[model samples]
Target: MRAELVVIGAGPAGLAASLAAAARGTRVVLVDAATETGGQFYRQPAAGLRAGRPEALHHRWRTWERLRDGLAASSVRVLTDHHVWCVERTSVGFTVHALLGPEQEEPAEVHARAVLLATGGYEHVLPFPGWTLPGVVTAGGAQAMLKGALAVPGRRAVVAGTGPLLLPVATGLAAAGVEVVALVESTGPGRLARRGRALAGKLPEGAGYAARLLRHRVPVLARHTVVRAHGDDRLTGVTVAALDTDGRVRPGTERQLPCDTLAVGHGMLPHTDLAEGLGCGLDGLAVAVDAEQRTDVPGVWAAGESTGIGGAALALAEGHIAGCSAAAHLRGTAPGPAPAALKARTRLRRSAAALDAAYAPPAHWPEQVTDDTVVCRCEAVTAGAVRDALGLGAGDERTVKLLTRAGMGWCQGRMCQAAVAGLTGCPPTPSRRPLARPVPLGVLARQHTQEELS
Candidate 1:
């Protein structure tokens, strides 16, 4: 496949970017790993499900409808189920290496003159005792199940986390007829109140979720954290504890809540694997972009959660700006102003920053992790192993990985890096891997032969 521009995601940002660029005369190809266009935020049910009211699963249904209908009517090519593993810089521009469909073995490629990365983000779930139980899932994973499959994780659920995501997940599960036992948030109300000025725009949306929670009669437990999950084979319950002003668990405030499901997530982190592979600069953990969302690398741009962990609105604004800039650059013309998008970007960014500040996980959370708790699920490495590695002079995550094999698993540290960093008292650092995902050796060998022949 070939195109003047390739947008690597079908989420809100990629959808908006592709439409914007196509409208400006750019031949764009929008690629995604999923079978559908909407990313996690606007995840849709499968066609086979024949959902009677898919829009009911989402809040911004009208916005999603517009994006979906716009793509269907646009000239841009849409390629779903293409799992991109690597992107190589070619003499002309770039070659996107991908695996076809769910099998993800057959190799495919898309050649493009320019690339936009809207790769999105993933949930950051800190490890707790019994978290590896079958019924314990990340808050996003639970939401994805309801949104994508029209299924609930369990009938009785405890949505425990310190982020804005918990509200929707709790209410959605409750509305789906699940008994939401409680919404346990580690962050206190005082923190959010302190950021009132910055989060003013989010008041209405928060209020709406609050109303839903109230309607569902779901108890809200603020300034609380899930200390541990309890189960023999699957999640049966969880121990909740109150947190002090300093983000430490208060003694004598621990209580056990009986629930079949524990949906927990501290927050999210940007998906920068592809950007790091492309040698793009990073502002801390996320991809670095200029005001127009263009990366430092020529012919490459990034928006949405790949650039930062903002919400859908910020991603849309950044995507529009990026698309307009990329189109103008390709057409050898000055970019036209996008005043409305620019304004939204500024305001939404402020709200995102405020949310980030207010919803931080408890500072002393690691203290609650039992020594035997498994931090790295893929390798089954325990917290004790990581602590032992620290005793062996492993001062950082890389050294801990080398000693304890904590991050040398299938995910290559994506899931366990934050946990390992917390256990080691080190900041999580950027990991640069040549391939964005695990590729079959056979596929690599075949690609090598083809490149040599070329």
Candidate 2:
């Protein structure tokens, strides 16, 4: 089907964008890989699960309800379970290719004059020993299980990570009746306090999470990290160690935290595969966007975590702004006198920037990896191999790829990009490619035939 605007990812960003554009008299189609509208932030119970008070697990329930209502009321065609694989520019506008089904074997496409990518970020996991065990999951993944499936990770859990998300996940697990043994944060209290001014202005509710953790009596181990996870078939315990100022594990400071589940996450990186495939310019790990949230490429825009790893609030603001901008451009209207939507976008952008700087990952984090620690789970690449490549003078990410083949797997480096970059001693680089995901040869042949016929 063709639409005036196609918003990829039905999360807060896409939902807000579609509703805003549809309200501005634009035909919109919102597509998502999941079965529901909310992205990771507002994940809901499955259709069959008759859980009362699903909002009890969520933070901003009212805002989500408003967006949900707007989507239902607007002239937006919502397509769930649409895993977009490739997007190509056409003579008229753009063509989005997707695979739709539980198995992702069915083909689907959406033609639109403009496209807004709201593809969200994924958890950045640095693997330790026994991470491959059954019970070790990312911090976000644990939240997804609890919020979406209404299931806890285990009876006892250890939440280890360096981010604001640790607090909620720890407290939530505790609230779910799981005994949270420890909340291990690698970033020191001094660093957190240093960023306090910026963080405070961005998220005033930050203190609320702290209060909740204190009330729950969860042990907050600052300046500590999970050095190794211990288990046979499932997580039995994890070796948590104090870190020096440089993020190196202090010898003889290791203490084992007994838990059945180890919920660990470093942070998040923006999902820019689709955007990078389209040759969109990137600012560090994020897609570079203009004031209007428009990419350098015409007829293409991006919002939410695809642009950067901000929380849902920033995403909502960016989506609203992008929708209005795209709608205005489509109608050939002058972009003047910022509307309420534009003002909100401005506010959100400021807030997102502050938070981004505040919660930035600790420098020298790669030093935490021991020689035995696995860096890439897909290829089973270890820290020693990466370090060897670096010692051999692998100057860039591409050279590191040649030396170690760290990014050649099916995930295409989504699982290992951050670690590889840190080990290679360089900034993260943008990955450019022709297709976002592996395409079926038959689909490509058919598309070419149709083009020739036309």
Candidate 3:
């Protein structure tokens, strides 16, 4: 496939960008890995599921409806179930290499004059004891199951995490007929109160979740953390403990909460694999983009959570700006995004910063991990093994991975990088992987042969 602009993601950002660019007379191709248009924020239940009221599971339903209807009426071509593995720079433009569907064996490519990356972000699930158990799902995973599958994780559950995401997960599960035991938050109320002014716009949304929690009669355990999960084969319960002012577990304050499911997450990190593969620089852990959402690369732009983890509102604003900029550049006109979008971006970014400061994970989280606890589930590397590497003069994440193979598994450290950094007291570094996802050897060989023939 070929187009003037390619928007890589079907989420709020990509959808907005595609619509904007298409309206401005630019040929746009919107690509995504899912079977449908909406990204995780607006994930839809399969048509076979016959969902009666899917809107009940999500917020901003009217906005989603507008985007959905606009997509159906637009000229932009939509390609779903295309799992992009890499993007290569060509003399003419760029070639996006992808695999098809769940099988991920067939090769496909999209050539475009310019690329806009709205790849979104992934949940950060810091490991603890019994975390690898079947019922111990990430908070986002539970939400995904509920939204995409119309299914709950378990009858009884505890939503434990230190981010804004935990609020909705706790209430959503409870509303879905699950018995929510409690909502455990490691950060105290005082932290949020400190940033009250900056997060004023989010107060209404926070109040809504708070009202839902009140309606469900779920207990809110503030300044508490899940020290360990107790289970044999699956999750039966988790041990919760109070955190002191210093973010340490208070001695003798541990309590066991019996529940069938433990939905836990610390935070989220941006998905920058494609951007990094294309040699785009990053600001901290997210892709670096200018006010117009253009990257340092000449023909590349980025927006949404791939740029940083703000909510859907910021993403939409950024996407609109990027689309306008790209369309103007392509058509030899001046960029003219709506002033409202520019204002929204500035306001939402400030609120996002406040939320990040208020929802940081507990400082002494790694101290609670027992020696036998597995840090890297894919590699089955234990905390003891990482500590042994530390004893052998491994002072960094790279050295520790080299010594114990903690990050050499299928995920290539996506799940364990944060935990390893916490354990080693070193900051996590971005992995400059060539391919965003693993490709089949046969498909790669075929691609090589095709290149030679051409």
Candidate 4:
């Protein structure tokens, strides 16, 4: 398929971008791995589920509906179940390669004058013992399950994490009839209070969550962390403890919370594998983009969580700005003023920055991991293994991976990137590779033949 723009996610960012560009007379292709377009944030029940009220679990439901309607009303070609694996620049534009089914044997390609990456992020999980057991899921995973599958993680659960996401996840689970034992936040309340000015702006919404927690009589444990999960096959309980100022567990702060499930998370990281593979410069964990959301590479742009781990609102604002900028660039027209959009982007950016600073992980978090703590759940690599690798003078993530096989798994390094980086005492470096996701050999051969013929 040929178009003026190809957007690689169906979330709020990609949906907004495709709509904006299409409205400006640009033929756009909005592709996603999901069978639906809401992404993780606005995940809905599958069409076959016949859910009674899908909007109840979601915040900003009207905005999502508006975007969905706009997408339906526009000329954008929406391709679901299309998992983009690679993107290559062409003389005229760019070629995007995707695997288009469950088996992923089918090959699909899009030719576009420009590409926008709204590929959203995944949850950052710091694993402990028994985390691999059933009923132990990330905070976002639990939310996704509730939002998309219309199922609860378990009958009783504890939401433990170090970010603003814990509030919504716990409240959503509680409201969905799941008994939430507690909301354990690793970051102390004092830190939140210290960021007074930033917290002030987001008060009403925060107050709403507080009120919900109070009404539900859910215990909120600030400055506490889940030291370990206890279970045989599934989660039976969790050991929680209050952390000292240095984030180490206080000797006498240990307590056990009886819960069938543990919904835990550290935070989120940018999903920049595709952008990095395309040789785009990164600003820390995010794809480095100009004010217009153009990456260092020509004909390639990125917005949303691929640029940074901002929430849906910021992603939408960035997507709108990126769409307008990309359309203008493709049309050879000087960029015109989008004053309202620019202001919205500015406000959202400020909010995202504040959230980032406030939810910054504890400095001494790594000290909490004992030798038995599983850091890389995929490979069953424990903290001791990583520490052993570090003790042997492993200099970087690559060396650590080679020595301990910490990141060699189905997820690559997505789940263990932060842990490995911290363990190795190396700067968080970007991973650049040829393909974003694994593709069948036959599909690769076909794409190669097609490329040669073209």
Candidate 5:
């Protein structure tokens, strides 16, 4: 496929960017790895499930429908089930390499004059004693299972986390008829009260979830953290404790909650693999973009969680601006002013900044992590091993990885990067990988021979 613009995601940002550009007569190719359009935020149940009320799972159903319907009317070409592995700069523009289908062995390529990366972020997994168990999953993972598959992670569940995400996940699970044992939050309500001004716009949404939780009779335990998950083959319960003002777990506050599932998450990190591969500068693990959402690399733009972890509203605003700028650039013209979206972007960004300040993980979370607790699931490295590695003058994550193989696993440190940095007391840095995802050896051989250039 060849296009004037290539949008590398199907989420709110990608959808908005593609529509905005194509509306201006620019041909765009919107590709995604998922079988459907919406990314995690707007995840819909699988079509085969025959969900009676798919929109019930989402908040902005009209917006998603508008984006979906707009694509059919625009010059945007949509490609599903295409996983982009690598992108190479060509003399004219660039070539995007992708693997097609469920097997991900067939090669597919798209040539584009300009590329927009709306690649979303992933949940930050904080490891606990029994996190590797079957019934233990990330907060987003549990939501995905419910939204995408229309299935609950478990009948009895404990939604434990520090971020604002726990509010929705708990309410959603309860709404789905799951028995929510408790919502354990690490941050105290006082901090949220102090930041009341910034949370004004979110009041209605938060109130709605609060109403749902109350209706479901779910207990909201503030200033609480999950010290450990308890289970043998699967999650049967979790140990919850109260955090002091300094974030240390208060002694004698520990209690056991019986539940079949533990859905916990601290927060999210931007997905910047391709951004780092293309030499884009990062602002604290997120892709750095200018006022127009243009990256340091020419002919490339990034929005959404790749730039920051704001909600769909911010992503849409950024995507609209980026699309308008890219459209004008491709046409040898300057971008027209977009006052509304700019204002929206500014407001949403302020809200996002406040969220970052308000929902930070517990200060003494590392103190609760025991020596025997597993930090790196793939390498099976324990906290004791990481502490020992740190004691051996392994000051950085790379040095620790070299000493303990903590990040040299299949995920290449995506799952354990935050935990390793937290445990090592070092800032997390992005790793540069040439390919965004793993590729089969056969695909490489065929590409080298240029025999399957289709």
Candidate 6:
């Protein structure tokens, strides 16, 4: 397939970018791994479910409908079920490599003159004892299951973590008829009050979730952190303790809550593999972008969570500016300023920063990790192994990974990097894989043979 511009990911950012570019007369192709258009935020229940009130699962349903309708009305070509693995620059433009089937064994390529990467983000998992147990899942994972499949993870649940995400997950579970025993938040409510001016815009949404939790009769245990998850084969309960002003757990405040499931998450990190692989600069773990949302690399732009962990509104603002810039550049014209979008972007970025500062995970949470606790779920590497690696003079994530195989698993550190970094007293580093995702050796060999024959 060929296009003037290709937007990867069908989330809010990608969807908005594709439509904006197409509306400006640019031939656009939108690609995504999911069969449905909405990203995690607007995740839809399966078609087989025949959900009577699909809108019940989302907060931004109306905004999603607008984007969906706009896409249907635009000239943008959308390719669903295409899991893009890598994109390479060519003399003419670029080539996007993807797997086109359920097995993801078949290679498919799309050529475009310009590319927009809005590949979205994933939950940030912080490990404590029994984190790898069967019934433990990320807060986002549990939300996705309910929103996309009309399924609940377990009958009895405890949603534990810091950040605004816990509120929605707790309410969502309660609405889904689960027995939510408690909502354990590590941050103190006083911190949120301190940021009232910055968080003022979010009060309405927060209040709604709070009201839902109140109506559901679920207890909100603020200033608390999970010490350990209990049960041998699965999570049957979790022990939580209150935190002091200095970020230490207060003595004698420990309590055990029984539940069949634990949905835990601290926050999120950007999906920067493709951006880093393309040699684009990064601002911390996020892909670095300019005012136009253009990456350091020419002919490439990135928006959404790939840029940072701001929510859908910020993604849309950034996507609009990026799409406008890419379309103008392709037309051999100077990109005009998107004043409205820029203003929204500026405001939302501040709100996002406030969220980061106010909802930061408790500092003492890592102290709860026991030697028996697994840090890297993929390699089954324990915290003890990571500590041992540190004792072996490993001072960074790379050395620890090399010594303990902590990040050598299939996920390639996406799930465990932060915990590993925290354990080793090193910062998380950017990963620049040769390919965006792993491919079967047979596929690479066949491509090699084809190249030789050509």
RMSD (Å) of each candidate, 1 decimal: 0.6, 2.1, 0.8, 1.4, 1.5, 1.1
| Per-residue alpha-carbon lDDT of candidate 2 for residues 1-454, written as tens digits (9 for 90 to 100) | 9998999998888988888788889899999999998999999999789889898898989999999987887889999999899888889999899988787777799999999999989888766667778889999999999999999989989999777677779988988889988999877767656655555654457677778778878888988888778887788999988888866778999988889999988888888888887788998889999988999999899998899877888888888888888888888884444477676666666666654554544466666667777777778788899889888988888888888888877787888888788877778777765666666788778878988998
**lDDT (CA) for every model shown?**
0.93, 0.83, 0.93, 0.86, 0.90, 0.90
lDDT of candidate 4 over 207-317, digit per residue (tens):
999999998888999988888888887889999988888777889889999999899998888888788777899998889999988999988888888888878888898
Clashing pairs in 2: none
Better candidate number, 4 or 6, judged by lDDT: 6
Any residue pairs clashing in model 6, and if so which?
A: none
lDDT of 6 by residue, 1-454 (tens): 9999999998989988887788888999999999899888888898999999999888878999999899999999989999888898889999998988788999989999999999999899899888888999999999999999999999999999888788889999999999999999988889989988888888998899989999999999998888888998888899988899878889999889988999999998889888887889999889999988999999999999999988989999998999999999999997887899999999889889999898888876678888988888889999999999999999988999999999898899888889988887888788667777888888888878987998
- What is candidate 1's CA lDDT for residue 366? 92
Ranked by TM-score from best down, the candidates are 1, 3, 6, 5, 4, 2
Superior by lDDT: candidate 1 or candidate 4: 1
Tens digit per residue, CA lDDT, model 3, 1-454: 9999999999999999999999999999999999998898899999999999999999999999999999999999999999999999999999999999999998899999999999999999888888888899999999999999999999999999799999989999999999999999999999999999999999999999999999999999999999888888888999999999999999999999999999999999999999999999999999999888999999899999999999889999999999888888889888974899999999999999999998999998889888999998889999999999999999888999999999888998899999999988878888777889999999999988988999
Model 5: residues with Cα > 4 Å off, grouped in runs: 451-454
TM-score of each: 0.99, 0.94, 0.99, 0.97, 0.98, 0.98
Candidate 4 CA-lDDT value? 0.86
User: How do the residues 346-419 of candidate 5 rate in per-residue lDDT, one tens digit apiece?
Assistant: 98998888888888888767887889988888888898999999999998989999999997877888988889
Candidate 4's TM-score: 0.97
- Kindly give the stretch of ten consecutive residues in candidate 4 with the minimal lDDT sum: 360-369
When 2 and 3 are scored with TM-score, the better candidate is: 3
